[model samples]
Target: MTKRVFIIAAVSLYIISAYFSFYYFSTGSISGLTQKINLPLVKYKPPVDSKGNVIIDTSAPKTEECPLSGEMLTKAHKALWEKRRPLGVMIENSIDARPQSGLTSADIIYEAVAEGGITRFLAVFYCKDSDGYVGPVRSARVYFIDMLSEYGDFPLYAHVGGANCNRTTGSGCGNGAPADALGKIAKLKWVSYNDLNHIPYPVMWRDYDRLPNRATEHTVYSTTVKLWAYAGEKRKLSNVDDEGNEWNSQFDGWKFKDDESVNPSEAGKIDFIFWQGKSDYDVTWEYDSKGNSYKRLNGGTPHLNKNNDKQIEAKNVVIVFMAESTARDNYTEGSHLLYKTTGDGEAIIFQDGKAIKGRWRKKDVFTRIKFYDTRGSEVALNRGQVFIEILPKGNTVNY
Candidate 1:
């Protein structure tokens, strides 16, 4: 009986030892595997995809209709103003380019105001394109103008450069004092071959110089004009462009001196405003000239010659608001990462005070934000503050 009892005890001890050995080995293996898989502790909700790749979420609440007229803003208009802000506003007499139709004769209006004590103006011109995307090519010119005129007398500066559509090999035009008749009206300070580099996508001076066509669209010119009220007192100011060109108080007026085509009736048709230390104006033409049926006064001439006779023949003027930044500073271009934290609720993003569409995960430890353009390619954000708000699920109050 004693031998049988001892045998049973030995078997029990062996079984317990074997079980502990297996448990320790399995536990150690699992620990090593966990270390190798070191993933982010925060749960990230990846963006949804369509066929094979990820797509940008642009279905958010956008300003579709024109803020003033209640008409739907077209894709082109949105694309232009989405990343630009006006230092001043100008309205010229012209026709609508979208519908390609003429309107009843009206006076051209220009208005300027001060923002944060800095004078700026908004210029609006009617455009008509007969064979372009829109009907008669009616369009507007929206951009920033220097406010140095307020300090003294500075000539109006325009930036005609390459479009962001193609970044590889594009440039701006440099039509300054020496080339154009500006020497008599204003002094050409500098000519640069680059676009204005603000936030988001800072325009690099070196890149501007590297552009191929320096005299064409790859260059920008700046000139200064002096306005003497009475005595020989001289008031000096500076006008600068993206290329770092400086204009002082010695520039002559419009260079197209030989073009003796001035209509008295058209004089009152164009209006002007001085705001933000800048001069903003618009000109409207009543009839097409004999030489050029399509050209009008105050219009952007394709070439430097006076033969084109491009005129500003617009009617209804709509002032579109320009954003404060460029494409590089406003959107996340190239490769970038955005992070956001959310409670057990919902989150929303707004650009220029409008909501962007997409689903956001709740209670996620950390979330990543990515941006892309209409073509599903990555984009860069320009300079300016974007509004971001986080709210609880089903709760109107933002967190």
Candidate 2:
């Protein structure tokens, strides 16, 4: 037994030495000394097209409309998407994790304050593939699960960890608190089915090389193609689950329309903040008339995707005002938050350089949230990326 222990220790030390040597050679410094020392090495590569070309061909005819964002794509892209379901990844927006990798690739994004005035994103990917890694992956929150449920039957959810309660003490969640995300996932029977929590290997990795000086919490990443493949092979979940039930059987996709011809000066800019004094998470969207899109700015700086180095732009920006409160469960140092998700709320829909005052409604967790203008008609979003921001009720949006 002593010999075996010594052998194991020796092998572990050798592996660690090799890892640091390689890191120093590639990055010119061992800045990860303070990062998570237990992180696994990055070994997976981004996916490539089988045809030896880019994922999307700009010259191809854009006939098929994506159900997620209503963006038109080639038949080839549509065919590829049909074989997979939506993937909701938990991406952090910490100041240290700026210029995230794959925000522009997501079809739809839901942003809300995770805790302590820091915002997080539940990026839903389906109609298109990410340019590369999709994170800086973070832990899950209960309200994010509520929003992700609208995707379909057994949507692939990827997160590192989550807010959990001490059921024995009845402190964090089980007694009455609704902020226990991990518990909720277990009750939903998504443990090994679709809830990819701390999944190792080809699903997720800690890429210290991506951002050398970042902390471990902000170094985790995963590619969309790898996530989909893992769901299919390991969880028996794809376009259909193990029982052969299609994912979209009860799905409710939002309505979409072409860009409406409108004057640019009508609603040229949008500004909002999640918390009172947290300027780092402040958001601004400037409308572009020619492109019919809104370019995003964070903390007064243009937010760009690290993968392609392009500014993050969206055709539609929907702001939903809901009641927010703290869980008071003491799940973590930051404390978890709870949001009223499955009810009616005031909303503002921005599209085609115009802002439409509207209301948002959702029947339940699985039901799709829809936006309706003051005239009581559904607001059709323009064809492109959709960004949904959930703000505290009574928070003001300046446009």
RMSD vs true structure, all candidates: 24.9, 21.5
Tens digits of per-residue lDDT for model 1, 146-177: 21222112333222321122223221112111
Tens digits of lDDT, candidate 2, 90-199: 99998988889899999999999998999999999998889888999999999999999998888999999988887676567644767889989998888989998878
TM-score of each: 0.19, 0.85
Best by TM-score: 2
Point out where model 2 deviates above 4 Å. 1-55, 167-171
For model 1, the superposed segments whose C-alpha errors exceed 4 Å read 1-63, 68-72, 87-284, 287-310, 317-399
Candidate 2 residue pairs in backbone clash: none
Looking at model 2, residue 129 earns an lDDT score of 88
- TM-score, candidate 1, is 0.19
